[model samples]
Target: MWNHFDTNGTPRTNNNLEGYNLKLNIHLSIASADIFKLISKLKIEEVDASLKYFRSAKNEKPPTRNKLYVINDAILLNQKQG
Candidate 1:
């Protein structure tokens, strides 16, 4: 009724569809992870832009209060709200 091979040389259908499903799932999971990372990056950029806009709107001066707090990378921009 059936033909099968075992490790010793029997034949079988045990090399079946289950493994195919697992391979598909692994690929799909990796793609979804990439999408999630892209969304997070977009959100962070949006927040940063919003902060910069409102800070600029007020046209305030940078703190002459502490010279040490300055970061070299900081835009030295952004005014405070009235």
Candidate 2:
């Protein structure tokens, strides 16, 4: 098991993720979803969590995009070269 805390010293748990799953199940109870679609939904939710900090009522601009782009570019370049 991984044990780590956020910058504010709050411990992380699967409770939040479980809640998301529960809600998704409830919402899609009658629907049939494919593996790719489910994975895409989870990935979109992950991106939302990462962007929450940058999304504030007072903040006009978020600085996370450039950083994420740089990291993604490096990974892509590595994959291409290797």
Candidate 3:
């Protein structure tokens, strides 16, 4: 039911979310972390997200995507246009 045809320059997959989940899992380092530990990690993520938001708000350019992704995006754009 999801359509990304008109959503140019946006991700077409959940890879980013999956990557974040993997990172969080590694940081937790346990199958079942204590509630307090989970809360602390969540707070850290919140602060990191806030910092990125503020930086973007100040007109700072975000980090570039990987070269592979850049190429893939170009190809997809060409396909969409043609």
Candidate 4:
């Protein structure tokens, strides 16, 4: 009856991957990653940046935006300024 509540702990990361620095390091240089991995990684990074941009926007105009097109252009401005 309690089976549903029993813990089913699982490793969140691949331990066997520890010895693969050279191999995994390749993932760091997106060019080394295959199309699927590259797209996923880039999409994740973009989503993270977009979330931060909008969260920091906090319903107020980001100063970098300057004028119209602010919403669409803020990310470019932030990138250049950074």
**Which pairs clash in the backbone of model 3?**
none
In model 1, the Cα lDDT at residue 79 comes to 21
lDDT of 2 by residue, 21-77 (tens): 897787556578777767877887788876775676557575554585566555655
Q: Which scores greater on lDDT, model 1 or model 2?
A: 2
lDDT of 3 by residue, 1-82 (tens): 1265576777788999999999999988999888898999999999999999999999999998899988877777777788
Q: For candidate 4, what is the TM-score?
A: 0.34
- After aligning candidate 2 to the native by TM-score, how far in Å is the CA of 11 from where it should be? 8.0
The deviation in Å at residue 60 for candidate 3 is: 0.3
Per-candidate alpha-carbon RMSD to the true structure: 27.7, 14.4, 2.7, 18.9
Name the runs in model 1 displaced over 4 angstroms. Answer: 1-33, 61-82
lDDT of 4 at 35: 76
Choose the strongest candidate by lDDT.
3
Question: In model 4, what is the error at residue 21, expressed in angstroms?
Answer: 15
For model 1, residues 1-82, the per-residue Cα lDDT tens digits are 1121112223223443677556545555664567766577667668976887787788866336334334411222222111
Inter-residue clash pairs, candidate 2? none
Model 4 residue 40 lDDT? 80
What is the model-wide C-alpha lDDT for candidate 1? Answer: 0.48
lDDT against the true structure, each candidate: 0.48, 0.61, 0.86, 0.56
